[model samples]
Target: MSRRVVVTGLGGICATGANVPEFWDNSKKAVCGVSVRTLKAGDEYSITLPIAPIDGFEDRLAEFGRDMARADRFTQLAIAAADEAVRDAGVDFASGLGRRTAAIVGTGIGGQTTFDAAYLAMLKHGRKPHPLSILKIIPNAPASHMSIRYGLNGPAFAISSACASGAHAIGVAADMIRSGAADAALAGASEALLTYGAMETWKAMHIMSDELCRPFSKNRKGLIIGEGAGVLVLEDFAAAKKRGAKIYAELAGFGMNADGKDMINPAVEGAAGAMKTALSTVGAFDPAGVYINAHGTGTLLNDPTESKAIRDVFAAGADSLVVSSTKSMHGHLLGAAGAIEAIATLKAMETGVVPPTINYDEPDPACDLDYCPNEAREQRIDLALSNSFAFGGLNAVLAFRRV
Candidate 1:
């Protein structure tokens, strides 16, 4: 028999919240986490920009133990979130499940903070870099850490597709379970690129917002970078049911495609095709009961192009469904954007409250849709879609249904 995958647990940490419940609560309140901050390197190089960064998280780092203490910020964040997921799922790895669990974590730019510190020490301070710098800076650090941390012995690796990394990791893990490669998996993504050097590079692109991220708005500037991690515990539906686990939602469908057009510019056809392909696995659905967690980066080109894609996929029903960008509250997490957004989508389905797209002062006709606006809205949501469109024209859409 063909297997089905279900989300048995969800965990997330971001600027808006330190964990899933907190994140969802802050999101529902439309609390904006974006603020002006200054980052410096070697006292000479510094950049001031609006960023959504977590504060007071350092106090909790020691609780993760020595290995995590020595790991990069990105991997540490992943462990923080994954710990919560495993606890929530009530999974005992000691009971033979560890041998069948896969750990698939993704990151767009891994260990940016560590890399910056190492480079600063070696180049600017005329000192040797950390001996374990390579291990911490590797993109697979999170995946490897999770495997050792949780005793997972199945397929473990990292996927780096820029912003789509999270969704791609989750999708691939689900496929693995469905194909009988694994019985359970820890999947998601983490990103910690809020360093001085990283911010300077992003600033050089001139695509970052000066103030707030206002997606689908006429006065939108651009995306504000944030750092954190989100993770999910996925298990074969039958096993989850047999174990009496509290299922959050069903991993119904996943779609991924590349634009093959531009490195920066998003393609409308690519976005629409991905959504359509995801829906193909969904069979059919009521448009009014759908909620889309948009990949609304609040950028000039992405907003309208994604709007058109939604219109293309849903056609007349596009106007009926509600869509919102929680990035307006939590800021863009780059690779981990899809993972936390998927958590947001699942929360919306669970609570029937669609989080708002905050900072929307003006609406653009080109990007016309029910964005929920600055206030959360109560609606019956039977289906949810989390969209992740990355640089290099990579797009991933995940569809979930109430289980």
Candidate 2:
């Protein structure tokens, strides 16, 4: 029989809040994380306004006055968040042994900060970069750091699927437990791509917000880029119950797909495919019984397309279901979006209150579905779906049920 996997702990460090509790409380208030950028020299790149940069963030992490040489901001995020998760899950990796504990973290842009710094240093001084520069710059560095730090003794790997990386990492880790690869797994994604080149790349796309991110709004402008990380502790149901661990929620199902036709644009068929697959994984589930955390980047192309896809998949509950975009409060975390949004979904389940999509001034014709606009609402949701669709037509959806 396939083993059951459930979420025991959640850790998130993002624009919303540092820890899970703080993050959940702030999200309940619909606090927008978008702010002005000082790095761009007065609107420097592709996405200027409403950029979600982490404030008071320490890129250099030194626990005992000895810094991890050449560590990047992205790796720091993973470490911080993972520390919280492992602690919350009550697992001591240093003392524990032979339990098949593992880690699977995801990243879309790995060490962009390290890569940029190395290039500039070479140009300015005409000298070779630091020896650990490459080690800090790899996409898998975050996952590697996590495993080394925690001393997990099972399989460890990194998942990269644009915005879908986090969800894929978590889902795949759950399967590891079910298939006897590990008794538990730490899963999520970390990303800090607020570098100059990342900003320039978004600017080239011209799909960033000028004023602010406005999801499900008629006057919606565009999306705002942000940075952060989120991590989760997933363990076999029997093992967690044996340990008397507090259950946060059950990661009921996961669905993923890519648009075969487009490199930049999203295909509606692929979107529907992912949603349908997610719903089908859990058999005869009612769509209205759950809340939804939308990707809702406030882009013209993404918002409407997402709305239509949801309607098609949940036709049974399209009119009454509550769906909102926490991105209005936390901004878009790119590769980390899925994991952070998953935390939001779990928060709604725990608190019994669904957060809102802020900045909803006017309603878009295409985005006519309910978005639980402008304020938090009281709702006892048992099941919830989080949607994240990224560039290159990558789409992922995860369904979580209250335990």
Residue-level lDDT tens digits of model 1 in 1-403: 4698999988899999999999999999999999999998989998889999989889999899999989999999999999999998998887999999999999999999889999999898999999999999999999999999989999999999999999999999999999999999999999999999999889889899999999999999999999899999999999999999999899899999999999999999999999988888876789999999999999999999999999999999998999999999999999999999999999999899999999998989999999999999999899999999999999999999888
TM-score of each: 0.99, 0.94
lDDT value for candidate 2?
A: 0.82
RMSD of 1: 0.7
- Cα error, candidate 2, residue 128 (Å): 2.3
Find the 10 residues in a row with the least total lDDT in model 1: 276-285
Give the per-residue lDDT of model 2 (tens digit) for 90-128.
Answer: 865665632478788889988988777677678755878
TM-score of 2: 0.94
Clash pairs detected, candidate 1? none
